[model samples]
Target: MIFSYFSRRRADRFAQLLDAPDKAEVESNASAYHHDAHDPELEKLLHLGRQLRQQMPVIGDQVRPDPDFRARLRQQLMDTAAARGIGVTATQEAEPDDAPQTTSVRRPGLRLGLAFAALAALLGLTGVSAASGDALPGEALYGVKRQTERAQLALAGSDVNRGQLHLEFARTRLAEAVAIADNPRLLPDVLDDMDEDSTAGVFLLTTAAVDRGEPSLLDAVDAFTSQQLPEVADLADTLEGEFRQRALTSLDLLNRIQDRSAELRRLLPCTSSDSAEVDDLGPLPQRCSALPATDEEESSSSENRDSGSQRGNDTPDTPDASPGQEVTPTPSDTSMPPSDGLPATPTPPSILPSPSTVPPSSDADSDDDSGFLEDLLRIIGDLLGR
Candidate 1:
């Protein structure tokens, strides 16, 4: 019971030390309390309390929250309480009204600044893209122009569309070449780019036309070459030396593209998807030796052959006449009667007869004559057929 009394007294003295306003008062009270109690536990507790009191102000300065954060935190507490179906009256009472108003006023300014920055950046890129459209090879924005074209090609829906884009870019490159014609360093490079784009575009367009069996698709290549050829020739005329040679080479390529397009159009009808021969372009057209016969031509030839056979069957076979008797010509026989004592030979039908008619020596000779006439008629029909 006596120890319990001392313990309660010690607690009361420690509580008083906590309330002390200055470090000197805390030190003075703690020394007096330690001397009266001679209690080691209470002395240790008092020393820790004194150290914490001394450090509290430093800790507060370092860990202080921003005014904006405090305002947001209070507002968040109110919002969270409202979300949970709890009364927000207590939270509202704890926070000042002006804090939320200040935050609301500041947020719009920050957002507006961010929006302006983003818009400025977008406009800057757009300006660069626009300026690059007219830029030449060594200009700063030229790479940007090429990159934009590549982006367009990436977004293209089909090879034909991409091919057309490549041709258009090639034209742009040609314009650049003309602009920099005085700059020997850049002229060759620009012309090279132009040639590359032209070749790529022609290959793509021709391949598409061959694959789809649509000769009309080659019209794009023709149009591009026709429009560019004169310009290229004029440029070649203006240039000299190696540059002139380069321009001439580009001109030749354009001519070749035009010829190739025309050839592909002529041959597209003969090509098929399963064609065996293919090049960098699509399938090569099969070389046709002869056009196929139409159904009407075949039917007419069949009818002619049948008629010739029927006529041969209708011709009557005559019995051998005596060598001493005079022979009479039949009504079907258009030839005059033979003057000599010999039998009249039957004439064959003459749809397409040989120039010289010979009397058949035997039945095999007659059959051979009929076969030769039928073959002649069929050849004529095929020649005249569609």
Candidate 2:
């Protein structure tokens, strides 16, 4: 019971660390804050905080305030009061008021000018941010999106928060990729960057997950894949061949990351009988029910190519011929079939008849051939009768 109480207190302490004050007193001896004894949950939280801290962007060495700043302010105040007709010696009082007048007038003007400049710069920065916030992945202002996240990470102090932030921005990148993916000129580059963002986000999430001993970030990835990725996949599926493959390739990369995490596999909703655990190099992770075709599609396509049964290759049978009737020959091109994949085997000259060998016959020629056949049959019949 006593150990449980201390663990609760430590949990409360760690909770406070989540909202740690800017000037909060941290232990000079870090060991004082770290205790080896804890339940699995508490252990996970500690590991999460540690990973988040490590993931946060390192802002360069912070410049501390000058030790004598207060003294400098005091001296400046004393000199200012002495100039404004307070505690002045008789010798100083007779001095021209023009010096102080100039100081007073110029100081206010200088301050006003600086204030205006600062306000203008702030407005400009805000405008840029607003414009960039709505920019898609391939657009020029997309760089602003990334730089903004870098600033966020620089400011974030919690590792858990930082990892989450990375995934959030990663989703934003994906949002952009999906939004502008229909534009052929823009899609390839945006998708490429989207892949990088997803890979990085997954990597960070995995690190945090391992440290925390749970796939906590899986929910976020699932949300992104469910909501945003479908559009990208749909757009890619509309394409005919290689471009479609490129889109699927990126999609698969993301799935591979998900495949490695066991918790993620259990959460996935994809279920294809063909996608069942096979001899996958990716270790045969469970799949979602709605995921697009994977290596299975590629293999199926290869089979289609090899068998030459691809679309537009059907051949019609030749029409039935009457006795002694010659049918008109169709064009060789029409007679033969369309082909794909490997070339059709060639018939050797020795075994094949020349095109001229098949003589063409008109309707008149067929009538003459039939009459001769009738006469020959009649003569044979008469000989048998005698």
Candidate 3:
């Protein structure tokens, strides 16, 4: 996918030449390019080949240089060689211009390989684009640069006004990302700039997106930084001990954080930056139902704040009661009648028979049974009342 995009223009040009015999001149011009730069003539040929290949599809069989065409092309190559202060080799010693000279275009095996190449090129050239860096828009590049700057500033503990300014800058970066369309390298950073704790946000965004079989958004946050987020690491070792543990990589964490921001925003105040603090560890104890409800409270506070909704795998424990112990599902049942206006009925108690009710072994009959009736009665009464 990446190579196709980067070479699309060249591919199209090659296709055009393939379809048009008159464009043999284009092929002729390309034959002069050879791999060796030490030889001026070869150097010229290499330049022309690079230009031509860069303008044509690297992998395909749509066209071949004609034998007669190549012979004539070699003459043109020699002519160019003479003009460039390089001695032209005799046509006799040079391979036939028209022998169907071949051009080799390397094929990339995966889409990411091409994308990474494009990224490298973008970095090298200071240009970002969906394809080769040639056609990048000025405004988009400026937006990304500004976003990077703002993110750095915001992260340095700047004030709200500075944060807001950074946020606005990030918005521009997002705009640039949208414009460039296929530049995944820009996405992670763009989303990062959208929040003050860009590292966490980027990590989560990368993880979730990768799971969905797409590009990860937080590409730059290192593993160490990603682990710093409470969900992915033991922040108790730091200041976020109240939060849960996670094992996501930095990019994965950031991507996930970004996703959480949307849902969290509906329940909390502040931008994604402020929200990160809450999401990393969640709202403080007063705002969060971190404590578990006791059996009695669980029954009594089903609809109230003490409902004890643990976020993830924390399960409530069952109370230890002997085999036939009765249990109340809720505490408020005794105080409130059924909403349907049914009778304010008393709960039926469970029953447990005394050991004497069953025939005992002849030898065991001598064992103590003093507390037997008392235990039986208590268990029976509790069941019957339920």
Candidate 4:
């Protein structure tokens, strides 16, 4: 939210305060801003600012600027200003050694020039960063892109935010790899960087999820892996040999993250992770036992058991035999033997009609069948005697 113009003005104001001729001027300027000169925080900041300003000369001495480069830069600025129809006055030559020196007046033009130079530098950096956003491996601006990512990670407000930034950078690396797919030499390294980012991101996010007992945080991990897995798999499909293996390794990492997220989701319902085991991914969630049956559930189960037992007791023990119908007797060992002393041939049992299909029989019919069986036995004995 801090605009460049506001930042520049603040920096200019601080610089003016730091460059004050004496402490009185600094106090006068501080009073203009309604800041007490004796305030502890203001004193600390001012002290630090003064210390930093004091070091500038030593820094300048250690790293001297190239005159030719400076002249070229100045000429380039003049040329640019001319192109934009702005007048840029040239610097005057130094005065004679014997000439008398007078009190120096602050040059508004010089201040304006410095401001323009700072603005130009800022714009140039902005343009480079914007261009670097899409830079691939071996490109001039790729290093800038990575540095920017590192800065973002360093400035992240929380572990979750840092994890997200890692994943975002990982996606950027993936795109870079895809852009440079033809460069086999660089592709593996890019993929390797992507994997490292993915690991760090997953670890941070998973650790946060576990420590906070918030499985919802894992949604980001799931989303990232789901989207990247297919793309990496496809890339692996198109590659061969070592490169393909490298891509497959990244794919494997994605798959592991996915499985880890799913497992965390399942475990998040557990009340505690105090006894959980730790691994490279973080703590493995402890096995959650089935919850104890609630009162309603226990009551429902008991009612069911009672109903089942009651139903069993209510069932009839024996069905009523229909009147005038003889019940078939089961065969017993007391049956008569063959008269000829030969082994009796066993008759195959016939299929019986169901009770519903049988017609009611009279008692006289049953008595006649019984007598007929005895008559058959007597005729067999008579044949044997003959």
Question: Relative to the true structure, how large is the alpha-carbon lDDT of every model?
Answer: 0.58, 0.45, 0.33, 0.57
**Candidate 1 ranges with C-alpha deviation above 4 Å:** 1-125, 280-285, 289-386
Best candidate (score: lDDT):
1
Deviation (Å) of 385 in candidate 2 = 99
Q: Which tens-of-lDDT digit does each residue in 1-386 have in candidate 4?
A: 66699577666667788788999988888778774345565467678988887887887775544455578768876764565444344233323636533322233576444433333322233555556777888887776666556545533556678778878878988888887777678999899789778877776677667666688889999999989998998888888899999998888778766766666666544313333333334444332331122224354334433432332232211122223333222121112122312212211111111211111122234444333333333332332333
Error of 3 at 346 (Å): 52
The TM-score values for the models, in the order shown, are: 0.43, 0.35, 0.20, 0.44
Q: Flag regions of model 3 displaced more than 4 Å.
A: 1-148, 151-158, 182-386
Candidate 2 structure quality by residue, lDDT tens digits, 1-386: 46698778876867665445432343322235556433466546756886676566453223333335557667766876676545544346546856553233233455444443333322233555456778876567666555555444433444445545655765676666567655666667766766655555554444334333344555665665565457657767765466677788766765554434433334222312222222111112222221233445455334423322221212211112122333322232132222311222211112111112111212233344444333333333332343
Give the range where candidate 4 is weakest over 10 consecutive residues by summed lDDT.
347-356
User: Tens digits of per-residue lDDT for model 1 on 1-386?
Assistant: 45697688777888897788877887788777555746677668878887887798787866545455689888976766665445544444545745553234233555444433333322233555556778788887776676666545543556678678878988998888888887767888898888778866776677667656577888999999999999999998889999999999888778766655655565455433333133322333332211122234344334433432432221211112123332332331222123211212221212212112211222333344344333333333332342
Over all chains combined, what TM-score does candidate 2 have? Answer: 0.35
TM-score for candidate 4 = 0.44
Please give the distance, in angstroms, between residue 218's alpha carbon in candidate 1 and its true position after superposition: 0.7
